[model samples]
Target chain A: MATFIDGFLWYFALAVFVIGVSGNLVTIILASRKVDLSVPRDSAFSGALRTLFSRFLPDQHMLSRIGIQVVAGYMFHLGLFILLFFAAPHVAFLEENILGFGWTAAPHWLFIVASQFAFLGIIMLWLYRMTNSVSRLISKLDDHVATILTFLVMLSGCLALLESFETLRLLHRFLVELLLIYFPFSRLMHAFTFVPSRLFTGAWFGRRGVDS
Target chain B: MSERLERGLSKLRSQIDPKVKSFFSSCVHCGICAESCLFFTETRDPRYTPIYKTEPLRKVWQQEYTFWGKLASKLGIAAPIAEQDLADWEELVYDGCSMCGRCSMVCPMGIDIAQIIFKVKTGLSAAGFSPPDLAETTQRAVDIGSPMGVKLPALQAQIGHIEEEINLKIPVDVEGSEYMALLSSMEIMYFPEYISALAKIFHQAGVSWTLCSDAFEATNSGLQIGNTEVAGVLVERIVAGAEKLKVKNVISPECGHAYTAIRWEGPNFIGRPYSFKVVHILELLDELLQSGRLKTTGKESSRLTFHDPCSIVRRGGVETQPRHILNAIAENAVEMTEHGAMNWCCGGGGGVSGNERAEPLKLKVFNRKKSQLEELDVETIVTSCSNCRLVIEDGLEANDMEINIVGLTEMLADHLVVDNSQ
Candidate 1:
């Protein structure tokens, strides 16, 4: 039964990842091609390196506590990135099928840390959506839906990771599979949307004689 | 001191049409808006951020209109949308925002924050929050047919006056002209050189154009009064005048917002399709340059820099043509750090320059642009917006700085070497 559950979650996750990754990659590639770099490239190697490093640092400028929602945003993102790269099943799949360069999977203790951070982030965000007038103003039906899905996924991931109970693990794997199928259609696709969108923005702002 | 504060609000709430109220119902506060605001950037005040500035209306929307707001309303938990609420937040809604779509550029949800603010202003105007000058202008536009209150014969006299000054046949209702020349209140009342330039260019290019004396003013109060009805009426007179003459295209002078009002908003407001194409005078000049119909002597001695007016550049999308013209006409056209679409606003936009309550606010805002000018160290600044020209002129005077503010036509007119030898 345990083996069957793992098989189901992995297959669904793989299918969704493949479609989401391809769709977003095509969008990014098309957008990049359409963007004109003909404006004399003022780009420096130093700026590229700094941009790469800055992603790791906190985006402190827009980070005033006013983005009380944004802090939750950062948390969900950070946790999702960690879990995507370092989860044991994901690592094994990446090594065998995709990268052919596998590393040791995160241990139970590490999943515990990731779960706490991801859950706390999701909760803070949920609280914000409920409390803040501004957040309430801008939020759509999908935002709350995404939050509920994330909460379920994080809650289930922890239960499954702890090997807490057989029934609980099945429940977690079932919900996780459901989300993998849903990810492509939802705002969860911001993961894919933001890449070329940022590049498109950078190119346009540069052309308009603006500082991005 | 006696308690003389009116403390009471106006009766505009019941007057607002409900379609606009639906617009106020739509803003969600993701606040991708903060970085897009000039006021937020300048003052560094969180309250000035477009999202924050729009809170009062957003609260009313959330409380009265939305699903959750309905729930809050039923429970008596949410505050009612009150007179004092609209009255208290008037400045925050109108004066705080310049209605620039910079915030809309960054909006992930594609919400037009500026449009929402304008709609809120409309609601406030219905709620009796309009400034006296705006009300006066609307009344003047309705009665005298111009925001500037120029009587029609008086306008024709001004036209005759400019024709004499320029030594050209300035035609009024000249039969079957190629273009219908529209004069903004800025040019008709104050800057005659621009009107003269129009005459000189039309004569030189050999393009037939005539101004209408019937409804001479181009300052549409719709943009100022937060109502499109007056704008519609003003636009109809102009559009009808164009149709009456049977012209090919309409040409707007160097007023930036007025250009947008005529070129873009005119078509949108008037509903029926226009037979004549609407155009900015800069684009007309660019067409003249492209066709080799008009050429500048390329003779200006002052080292110049171009400031892209938000009206012409961002709103009108005529940024390139003006800069192209400026570079062609000037010997040394150096760029200020922020030029083109991202250029800092001259702080005179959104009818704020003419608003008496916002006059002090305009100076504070113009300081940002003034400082940018100081940094560039250019002697002459050429811009395309008329209101920008007025505000920047007021700003320079207030700050005791000496910088020449030349309109595109004024600069173009100066470069014209009329053939006296012929």
Candidate 2:
């Protein structure tokens, strides 16, 4: 059981993660070819680049209106980013198994704080989605599935943090594998696709001389 | 099984470009666009959420475009899109939305919610589910050369009246003029003062401009109805008129959607650039003011605020021009809480005013503007779009608010410094 979990399933998940993400990206890029023939009032590339970064900072006027979502979204995304790349176990796992190189990991206390933030944020967002009328109306089966699966993965990973129980670690690994397989097909693709999505909209607004 | 349903589905299929795909993929049902929409804010109905309004288009995208959706359909599990779906969405797409683009502005993923909803409107139109009043207006626009049925004789009558009132010649079809001006049917019928105002301002500025006798109507109901074929026909009339008169520039009248249809979307609709340039009347007036051609005196004593029309300021990129004109003429030109490009819509844009069925809903949503005005406590409201003026007048009357609404051009004309040299 240990051998299959550590070797075959691990490699399978990694392969699917890599290939599925790239395949989905290539498909999206080739899906349409829209040539705008109108005269542009501004540079499309500059507008795209500006929006790619500008969206990270909410507009001052909108901050009060969307304060809760903005704060919770940042906490979840930033904490998850740190836990994924900078936590000691994740850094060790990548260096030993995938990259053959290493960077210094976050301190043990910081890792604990990050996971707590991630858990708090994800729970808040999921609860808000269930409660809010607009969100409830638009939420699909896929959205709930993605949120629940992400929560289970994070919960299992926290249980496995002690590194003493093989079952806990394998549970985390299996759930992550499922998430990997589901990522490209689900709205989780927003993580990488947001750049190009914003670029398309920004270019359109740029041609019309409006800031996106 | 219906032909309209088939045409609608085909159009929806064609509208699913890469941007639509990306927008759908990036949206996570966050529901942030709800707070930005006045309809949802006023009604508290989840159905009015801007993103939820795109459900039909999104369903079409999922069923036909996505991998899992395609597989589910192949297995006979996914629900097929039916005629009822399009029929139900007609009210939501036409009556419940003003296309203010506030949702587009607030979307964190940078999705142009308004543009996507426009594609949905195209589908609804093709499915023959447009509001009856808007459809009738579009038909009249196609058949009578103007949506309000204002013909050359009527305009000539108004021109004769304005010429007599202002003591200035209103040029018509004058060859070799520097600019060819177009008027909205509203300006011609309800507010002939706009014509006299333009004559007064143009004469003071010494600019050679003429109205096209053949294509004086600037508003395109095709754009409002989301019918490209009819929109192209309206734009072509202006193009033909401009070419015939050999004008260097064409000034779009102070109507919101007319400016958008003529100045921005006209070239693309007609599939070619124009020999003459298109400029909004506000843009031309602002330019003349900056260049010292147009001058104004005697500030308006009443405290006033400018209502930025959605299509003119937000969608047309003429945000600063109206403010420039207003600040120059009004002694106390205040601003609303959310002014300029982000101002709340007057709830009558996107042909809502033309649709009689939407009047009640439009008035309900005008609570947004009501609160904005209440906050400012201005004596009068000035706007550039005639549609906004009329709609706000209706809204103010329905709510029993005692606010006077004026067009920016007429207001500016009242303050024009008559040159003694002339």
Candidate 3:
């Protein structure tokens, strides 16, 4: 069971993740946009590039209004990013199974802090989504599924942190594989889609010379 | 599904371009956009949330585009969009939203919420779910040269009145003129002073401008009603006029959507780059001031605030020009706490003013602007868009607030240096 979970299940999840994400991206690219023939007042390229990064921080007017989402969203994203690439176990897994090259993993202490941040961020965001009228109304089953799935993955990863329990590690690996397979289909696609989303909106606003 | 629902769904599907796909994919529905929307902020109604307003389109995209959505639909697990859905969304997209683009600015995913809502509007409009008032007005626009039914004769009469009052010829169809000007029906019928202001300012600045007898009406009821075909026809009319007159620049009058329609979306609507460049009235005035052609003599002593029209300033990107012109005219000009690009809409734009069905909701949402005004306690408010000026005036009257509203061009015309050489 361990061998099948570690080998075939893992590779299958990776294949599904890659194929599904690539398919989604191709579908998006194939959905052609109407060419804007309007005379541009500013460079759409610069506007797209600026918005791709600038949206990381909310504007002053929005900052106070969306304080909770801004802070919690950042905490979750930054924490997950740190954990996904920099944690010791993830680095080792990537080195052995995916990258074929290894880099120095973050120290154990940083991993613990990142995991805590991720856990707290996801919890607060979910709580807020369930409570806020707007969020509650707009959120779909996909959101809750994405959040709960992510929380389970993180929880299992933390439980597996002991390194002495092989069962705990396998459980973590299973949840991670499930998450990887689900990533492309769920709201988790936001991790990749946010770039093009910002780019298109930025270009639209940019063409009109608005700093959005 | 009913035939109307099918047609609406087809239009919604067609609107799912790469931008919409990407925007929908990126949205996690955190609902931060609600705070940025005046409708939601004022009403505290979750349905008014900017993203929620796009539910019709989202439903179509989900059922037809996404993998699981396709599977669920194929399996008959997902509910198909009904005619009722379009009916329900008409008010949400038309009445509740101003298409102000404020929600678009603050979206973390950078989803253009207002743009998507516009798409939803297109679907509703095609489905025959639009308000009757907007429908009648749009028909009037297509049939009678103006949304307010201001015909060429009416404009000519107004021109005569303005010429007699200002003692200057408002040029009509003068070939080889440097610029051709367009006026909103509201400006011509309700505020003929706008024409007087334009003539005086142009005369003082020594600018060669003409009014096209064929395309004098600038307000696009087609755009307001979310029918791009009608919008395209209206734009083509102006293009024909401008091309015939051989003008170098076409000046959009002091109206919000008119500037957006002419200056920005006009070329796109017609699917061709314009031969004559489109310029907003404020942009022209700013250029004149910068070039030392138009100069102000004195300033207004009253404390005035500039209400940045959403379509002109935020969506249209003529932010600083209004401030520059306003500062030149007013001694104690104050800005609302949320002025400029982030300024709130007066709840009258995006055709809400024309939709009589939306009046009560429109006035209710005006509380957002009322609070912005109360924060500053300014005596007068100056804005560029005639629609915004009228709406704000109506809002003030409804709230029993004693404040004055003036068009920026008319106000600036009052301060012109008075070129005696003419």
Q: Write the per-residue lDDT of candidate 3 for residues B1-422, one digit (tens) a residue.
A: 78888889888998988889888989999998999988898889999999999999999998888888999999999988889989999999999999899999889898999999989988998889898999999998889878888889888888888899888999999999999999999999888999999899898888999999999889898888889889999999999999999999999998999999988888889999998888999999999998989989899999889999999989988999988988888899998988888999999999999999899999999999999999999999998888998899899999999999999999999998876766
Q: Give the Å error, residue B151, model 1.
A: 2.0
* lDDT for residue B103 in candidate 1, whole number 0-100: 61
Clashing residue pairs for model 2: none
Q: Which stretches of candidate 1 lie over 4 Å from their true place?
A: A1-212, B1-30, B60-65
Single-chain TM-score of chain A, each candidate: 0.73, 0.95, 0.96
Taking every candidate in turn, the Cα RMSD to the unseen true structure, in Å, is 9.5, 1.6, 1.2
User: Number of the top candidate by TM-score?
Assistant: 3
How does residue B94 of candidate 3 score in lDDT? 91
What candidate 3 gets wrong by more than 4 Å, as runs, is none
Q: Flag the better candidate by TM-score, 1 or 3.
A: 3
Tens digits of per-residue lDDT, candidate 1, A15-125, equal 886776566455335432322212222343333233323333333433464466567666776887777688886698689867989998888677667767777877887
Q: Candidate 1 residues B1-422, lDDT tens each?
A: 11211211122332222322322322334454665566766676656667665555566545544445677689998666666666676776666666655664444433345655665666666656767787788888888887787776776787788877776777888658898888777777788778888888878888888887774577777776677666777888888898888888888767776775776667656666578887778888988988989867856778778888876776456777987787777888888775665577777677777678887777887778888889878789888767778888999999988989888788887787677753
- Which lDDT tens digits does candidate 3 get at residues A79-175? 8988889988888878987789988998988888888888888999999999998899999999999899999988888888756589989988999
- What is the C-alpha local distance difference test score of candidate 2? 0.88
| Model 2 stretches astray by more than 4 angstroms | A30-32
lDDT of 2 by residue, A4-76 (tens): 8778887887788788777867766776665664556568887787767777777667688678788888888
